[model samples]
Target chain A: MFKLIKQLTSLVAVIAVLFAFTTESMAAKKSKTLKNTQKKGFVRCGVSQGLPGFSNADAAGNWTGVDVDVCRAVAAAVLGDANKVKFTPLSAKERFTALTSGEIDILSRNTTWTLSRDADIGLTFVGVNFYDGQGFMVRKSSGITSTSQFKDGTSACTNIGTTTELNMRDFFNSKGISYEPVAFEKADEVVAAYDAGRCDTYTTDKSGLAAQRTKLSNPDDHIVLPETISKEPLGPVVRQGDSVWEDIVRWSLNVMIEAEEYGVNSANADAMKTSENPAIKRLVGAEGELGAAFGLDNEWSLRIIKQVGNYGESYKRNIADTGILPDRGPNELWTKGGILYVPPAR
Target chain B: MNFKLNKIIPQLVTLLVVVLIFGFFAFNAQINMDNRGIEFGFGFLTQESSFDVQFSLIDYDGSHSYARAYLVGLLNTLLVAFIGIIISTILGVIVGIARLSPNYLIERTAAVYVEFFRNVPLLLQIFFWYFAALRALPLPQDSEPILGFSYLTIKGLYTPSFVWENLNIFFYSIIAAIISIVVIKNYAKKLQENQGKQLPVFSISIGLLIILPLLTFLTGGVSLDFEIPVLKQLSTTGFIYEGGLSIPPELIALTLALSLYTATFIAECVRAGIQGISKGQKEAAASIGLTPNQILKLVIMPQALRIIIPPTTNQYLNLTKNSSLAAAIAYPDLVLVFAGTALMQTGRAIEIVSITMLTYLSISLSISLLMNWYNKKIAIKEK
Candidate 1:
């Protein structure tokens, strides 16, 4: 009788546990992250540790840059205030894990969108904000202008757990030049190692090279080679299984780009709400129900534009005026003979 | 019978509850992963890694599989641990003995070293060694070779590579010499026990070891040559030593920091072990007219080892685990390559992290088992 009692209780416990899990697994209709962010009254954003023109924080801990503008745009659209954002600075290795593990609602770091990261790693890349390419930086004293002067046994310094490692290998192998890769976990460490003359060249994204070059002891000593090794379309990322939150972030960035195309600055965003053109009016929340699809108010896009400004304004404030990259180059809009294009906000 | 049933029933209930909780969590993870469209599998191990490592012991390239990359990382980790344990043991024994020396300066220095290195965090020390100390080394262009054949620069220590001819024959000769020395030592031990004779076995073993390996070079088809490193210029100012064994500064810094930090604790363990022995035991050995060296070797050391082995084994294990800090300095150890880079690339966080944890557990257990065996061997025999 005692043995039978034990057996019966164990069987009952197992079935009850199964029921609990099965009930919880019936895929959520609404985004848990969105609900959590709303309850907390802030959007949890993950950005880079410190990239100058991407998502760098000032001495007062106020984050600014194009990537920061993405999360700020989201905060304006969702939370109704641009400053209602908590930024979690992440390393290259910890960025995706931070997003997928629910540590952050939106990872607006300058993370490259690759197939494996999007399709395999439980992450969804909404859209590209920065189109970058891997490039090499050599010391000006090395007297090497192009990558063709790179010889066998040349050591290269780069950050670990980044697409730069893979691209570096591809570049060196294609050129049949045997090279050494000294990969560190932090960007600052790579710069320090390269500045210490431990490596013959430093390799990362072209923009990164341009930004980090200023940090060297003598900024005039290094020169970036004229070689773009791989295509790196860096963008914001969100966790999988939350399409609604992903669409909200996606449209937030798209609205910024579209606003830039429509010549709507933050100063004129309110005036543009009464513009003559329908497309311009829709961007400022005057002509359409575009906000309804995202479960937001009609003023969401307008708030983003008026508070966070358009993409061009963000680029000028953070990247160009800061002297990281003076030219607009490929980051300029499609109508201005650049590749920054987005689907029209209809 | 009733009492046994009463005890067993509660224990069984507790065990069942624990098992059910564990099962629920495992099931929850599976379901959550399923909903997120993240596949859980180790099939990526066989896929092409498509990544390169800076310093590897084995022949590895980006063309190799991820498993091969994993092996390279494991080997580098083991290499650091092996070198650290050996160096820390030697340093610890000397410093332990020095701390008790009659010389005031030597004892004070030893005391200061143990307190300073042990109290500072190992990570800070690692950073100091790599970022501060190693960075101060000269660049390859301006480097001066220390031994006319080896260059120690910011990049690494490039030494002359050994080019051996018929290495197998040379190894066989050395093996033959070791076998004979062991056989002779056994005979000498029995002769001492049965016939009260003491042969000079140590001298004989040394003679055989030298003659056998030397004889291999004379006639057994063994020849050795050194491939000296030559400075090669990448650009006008960039230079590197090629055609030799280049040990990266990462390995040197990590090994130096691990051994130095771990040696301090090991030195304390040794000091405690030596001091724990009673003074009467040494006085009694002196009364028996035994020499001081014999008293130390045959009497004091045997007892002190029983105290030292266990704690020293702990320090060894700590050194092995702490070698994972090589990730910070980019030594490509098991953590940096397998957990840091591989996990980031594959995004199989659960699988990769679990495998890494299990690997560290296995390495630790194996070290523990080996130490336990040695402890048992040197333990005081009881009737």
Candidate 2:
């Protein structure tokens, strides 16, 4: 019997070793995402399954949104065509693994850049595209206009693994009010639960709240509370140990912002190339070695602007145009009374 | 000698190949982790989880360790499985017997039930219960109390919980009762075997179970108090039940879906077991002047159980595994709390997922081991 037990233990050890091997083999080879993506002629970008104005699809299966446009801009910069990108819709639970495991070259989901996620998760946050904060949405009929009115024992629903859950706890704990959280794995589940009145309030990023409110049966019945609890710098992410790939994704996002800062959008990008303003000239890639530094052509920023438009244009087209939330608020350019400031292309 | 040598050579080659494959994988994983600069360790288990579970059977909060969070998830999973198993077993037995009923309506009803629940996917059923049916229930302020103590509302089902004093003594009394009953049962069996005189063991055991537990409340310094749920208003419109046990709607939906789906398969197992009993055994017991009840109790049930147990145990294990689908509806089961939330929080995917899988594997193996032992114990001894 002891001998049989010993053999059984060895068998289990063998099986564990086999599983470890299989999973490792399943992972895409390390640090070759950039080369592989270029060779494949399309960028595999991960986005949320469906969060309107962030990363969502229409009935015809055409993907469009802010996150989708980021991927498009990256594709245009790297491959010279915005359409040379494939969007893999990922849930919050699988987004990081999907990126680290090489299933997707870039994760453009509306993911927050937390310190632990940056340092510990074998991933790097490229840059923030949308400056957001956690907030709450409650029913208008509840007679509660502000978050302070959410007395002790208030129930709120939010996604489980996002910063929203932790922020909710922090907001309530600091206020010394006890609350119950009805968390779900999916964003849609949280929304559905809140719509069904399982929770008195729905909490997520304010942008997420705006996008999700449009899905509710009676959108007008809900009101977003006027308190932003935690700062959420939502942005694109890439795997760690791949500085080349990280720089490409980061600069792709920055170039769009810099173009917007210089008032050089897609419609006027070619026209702006003639301007002698050195900043505009450099941003349009008319006279600078900025593109070569990132291993792209001199006209990389021009391709990004020409194909996917500037950051503001992408926001206005996908987000503001959709009327999910017309006011860009903090997502606007720095000179235009918002905090969107990108460093010089030089 | 030649045959044995040939066999040993092939076996040795296979073992070498397996070892080589494992070594290759371990080396690759090491290189992969090194490349990513991600440390591989189980040290995270002792760190503060800093994540709250929506529903847990134990006292848990954000301050507890991840190990504690895992325990909460495991306990919640076991709680759901335990309740599901008991309810499904009872329902399955009734439905199984009803399917064999002489009444056409009864048998048809049972058949329809089995077909309906068995055909629908469990995930969809959970969604239907949680998202649609439970959502349609009245809000807390509008809901009428059930039995003047509990409220079933869209938020959750609020019921009274008992506050017990000296609960350990009560538990000890119950254990004592069970021990004494076992002793008496053995003594009665010995008497029956020796003198052919039967004792009323069933009644005596039931009496001991009830009386001893009651005796704890009377003289063992045990007291119990009921804390009923009370409605409290948060805002003008929002009302909630306070000061009692609140069973979250997620658990209700998960348990309901799991049992309803599994009971169909269990019902089929039971039906097949009973039908496998031949008519000869029944007729023989009846010809020996035994009543119908006696024939069923003495001859058919024992035979039927031997056929019923193994497969039914498999169904129970499947139900436990299917409880992992609780992640879909956010029931905070082992999968949702540990594998889903904790893995997302820590990003230690390999370690967390391996732990979760091993936990389930151990559960399955232990249950199967117990069932095997029981099967062996009840196997008929050959002459």
Candidate 3:
């Protein structure tokens, strides 16, 4: 009996070692989501259903926007082509689940970075691409020029599953106002209801209000009230647990901002590889091995810059050119009296 | 022993495989969730929801917990289902009976309604009613009162809210009337069976039902009043009716679409049930000196109900499940408020989804149980 017990113990030890070896090899093959993306040859990206100047698709099925450019930058870095991205249009309620469930590799849908979302959910916000604030839009005929003019029994329309709902309550509760919240699951329905006079005002991120304002029957008739209710830092997000993939997305966005700061546009990116500034050379993949960390060629950042352009170019082409919040507001560089700043990529 | 082993071993192996498959899936999900740092638990239900809803049956606000918000959504869903069931059952019976009518126009019309409504998808019907039909209603300021003080407008149907004094006394009076009517009905049945006597039970029951509730106003200390809606303007073009029980246009559209859609199926069930009753049963009842009404009520209806209850129960379950589409039109039903909004807020996908599935399963099961019990009560006894 003792001899049999000893043999069984030996067998258990051998099995444990075999299991350890299997996991160790498997971990290398499946270190994260990067291997899957590389094998698939396209970056799976999640975007909003349709928010013009952000992630809306054109009549020809081409998607272009600052938010779309983020995923394009990632695609260029990892897959060596900016256009190698398949966009999945998601609702406000579905974006996070789509990302965390491996349905999409990157979620660049103008999602706000909130404490609960960043820390609690299985998601990581890469960085902010747009700085927004919640505001109310009322018809010009109402003569309600400001949020202070909103009266009791006023009905507000908004999308559900957004921070806008919570902020609207805060704005009302703080001001001691009793308002009706007509929350819809989709942005289009909210706009429709608000347009039909079912709601006294519409509320969302100010940028969203502007983009959606263009869809109204008479765009000039509705006016967004000048009151910033809540700070909304919108950005791209990725699934947690894949630090390599997370860093690749984070630095891809960072590289775009850094290029813009150094006055490097897509037209001048390839030529600037032989620049005097070490920072510029490093950005254009002329000086350092920055791409080694993400298991890619040294030209990853350069490809991102050459294909998707810099932060300023993305903003100008997608947002300013489209006539949606053309000013850029606080999204400009820190040197230009704005808050757009990122760490140096050494 | 060998025969038993042949059967039991295979069964055991099949059960083992099923359990192993389920266990593997659960284990894989747990590992993935753990790796991603997503804690799986129901602790979030007790946290503050901090979001406002458009309409609620009970008191609710941002200050309430997540559990309360779930309750609000559940109540709204139940409310729609309850109202839809009642309206559909009434319309279904009429259409079912009309289909059997000798007049070609009546039968054709019923058939057309059933075919058109049942064939067209329910989601599109809901969207049409909410976005197009209700969208055509006038704004509050432009609304003209329909049926006296009630106003039908884009906002909602603004009807006078009933305010009762000593409402409990009124309910107690109603209970007393119902109990006495049941007693009288049983006694009258016994009298007819034994002595060939008859009583005007229908008239007596109706009189008792009306007079008891009415008597509460004079002697039982029950009084009632109506608070009529008044139109008020919020802005130059924004207006709403105040001081009444306002039925939201969302609820109106959802109820209208659900009843119209489900009534088609229920109508088919009813028609099938009535047709299942044999002509011999009707002839036998007529030969026994029974009137047409008596033949239908005593012979045809009792037999027909056995078939009707089971299928009608399925329709009820379908209607309840279909009501989840209320999320599309902003009706604040279970899917919208709890599964949609609450799931987004908490990010508890696994937990919230499971709870929602269980809730729906329980509702369907309860309906099935009630119908099955009733079916058994009316089933033919083998003895």
Candidate 4:
């Protein structure tokens, strides 16, 4: 009986080990299939929660944003359904790992593409979604105007797992200044610290600075610095190995820029299906198999436009209409003296 | 032959099954890590960390290697554990004695303390102290000095950082006092055994301990000084304290929770140790012409320690392990600095996580080994 019992226990252990291995293998296989299906060819997009003017869910929980349009336009060119894409809202720390792990097809979470993150972490940055910089917000009574004027030994409030933290340290260090840092893991904590007078200044992205300022008890009392110390080129990121997935993500962003340039929006998209221009005709898939190379049909771009709208349409509704408008700045298209340029659809 | 075969075959089969299971996991882990391009290695320990820790017991910067960072984290963890153990021991003994007190109010008050702190989770207690409790403090500039030496501010508790001069001479004096105590204890034991004479060994040991350290200060050039924090303003509004050591609120909260939580268990152990001895033993000692103090010193303590040491050691071990929760409050403990941040940067999840888990396991195992030896030494000698 003892012998039989020992045999049974060992058998259970072996079965448990086999179960774990098979489950892991099955999970890997499923992910591979998901990747192939996305590339053959649908837009696998990731987005954020209601961060008004950047990315947010509507009353129905449908994502709309300057960042979201980048994904939708790619879907239009690839899958023929801009609504065919999947959006996943990610926390600050989860964003990078999600992209690297292939858990999300693409990350467009206002994530800054840094040199070390790009080169060392093995991720590909297709294009910039927003060009921002780090700034500090302080109470008006603090009498701190420029970041340079802020002396050493002041406790500055900041968030963890963001380039804004590194920028704050490097900027202060370069100026031969030393400050006691008070870091928190969330935006709410940083806001609370600043509001409670626990910190001399709260530093983050310029857009984040604006958002956090609104949450303060006296929004008018806080002033953000104008000297943008670091270049935070926020954009979408993808895994390193898959070229097919990378191309799909890159073109999705380009399609949005191209649509904005061509004046093709959700309202005019159906009319564009009968346009005279060969470029528009081909893009609308009224003519050729340009998308089939991406493992998608020719009507893919049209569907994307119909579902999510053009870049200009998305930007205006998501960011500009609310309060922050792209004033012919870096976000404007190349035709209007901006840097947003797209590769021609051959 | 058949009976022997039954035993041999089953043992062989069990061994084969255990080996097979291990082999399967080893095989899959190899393949899975290879497919993901993650190589398992401890080489990251020597690589530049490029991360800054907020609180450290030792000097550290991003320029330091990951190994140094681990040391910083390990040392900080030990520091908190040591402080928590000392505080809990004192609090636990007092509360445990009070719980058995004749006075109704004192007993009730001790019971209330034990019940209130014991029920709450250590993490919540830490958060309450750090976020809600510490946040209510005055700013550095407005902070009133405590005892004219320390400043209690929202940033942290800034106390006078000690500057020791000729510390080695002072340490030698402590060692000398300890050696004399051992000699005196042995002499007293011999006097009690061979002759019917008794010596005041405890008082002599106490006098030696104080007098030796004092002698070093007077003649051996041993000195100590306090670096008090002074408030300084850089700008019109911004102010900070400098020159003194600042203990971050995270450490304060973590230690506070660990001590208060562990004290309840330690109190139970203390009460059990005291209550364990029958009333008959006290009466018997009195009948044998022993004084009350002598009965406590020679009989009760030796007996109570036998009961107390085991549970108290367990509490110390629990406190050490629970210190890992310091990660939640960003206390730069072993879990936060080494496991969380270092693993993210290096992408060496398997290696780093295993090392950290093994470190904690070894600490626990070694303590258990010492406990076993101590238990064996104190066991009753009987035929």
Best by DockQ: 3
Error of 2 at A295 (Å): 2.5
Q: Encode model 1's per-residue lDDT on A116-209: one tens digit a residue.
A: 8999989999999898999999999989999898999999999888999999999999999999989888899889889988899999999999
Tell me the deviation in Å of residue B189 in model 2.
3.8
After aligning candidate 4 to the native by TM-score, how far in Å is the CA of B355 from where it should be? Answer: 2.6
- Chain A TM-score (model 4): 0.81
Candidate 3's DockQ: 0.63
In the range B1-383, model 3's lDDT, one tens digit per residue, is: 99999989999999999999999989998998998899989999999999999899999999999999999999999999999999999999899989988999999999999999999999999999998987799989999999899999888889999999999999999999999999999999999999989999999999999999999899988999999998887777778889979998999999999999999999999899999998899999999999999998999998898888889999999999999999888999989999989999999998998999999999889888988998999987889
Model 4 misplaced regions, further than 4 Å: A1-91, A99-102, A119-122, A320-329, B1-23, B272-314, B379-383
**Cα lDDT of model 2 by residue, A163-246, tens digit:** 877788778878988898887889888888899889989999999999999999999999999899999999999989888778
The TM-score between candidate 4 and the true structure equals 0.85
lDDT by residue for model 4 over B251-283, one digit each (tens)? 888899999999999998988998898888888
lDDT of 3 by residue, A1-346 (tens): 9999999999999999999876543423555688888889999999999999999999999999999999999999989999999999999999888888889999999899999999999999989999999999999999889888888889898999999999999999999989988889999999888878788889999999999999998999999998999999999999998888888899999999999999888999999998999999999999988887777789999999989999999999989998999898899999998999999999
The parts of candidate 2 lying over 4 Å away from their true place are: A1-31, B187-199, B218-221
Model 4, range A90-157, lDDT digits (tens) per residue? 65655666666566777887878876677655577888877778888887877878887887677777
- In CAPRI terms, where does candidate 1 land? medium
Enumerate the candidates' DockQ scores in order: 0.60, 0.51, 0.63, 0.22
User: lDDT score, residue A39, model 4?
Assistant: 53
Off by over 4 Å in 3: A1-31
Query: What's the lDDT for residue B358 in model 4?
Result: 88
Count residue pairs with overlapping backbones in model 4. 6
Each model's fnat? 0.72, 0.67, 0.75, 0.17
Alpha-carbon interface RMSD for all candidates, in angstroms: 0.9, 1.1, 1.0, 2.8
Where does candidate 4 chain A have its weakest 10-residue lDDT segment?
Answer: A25-34
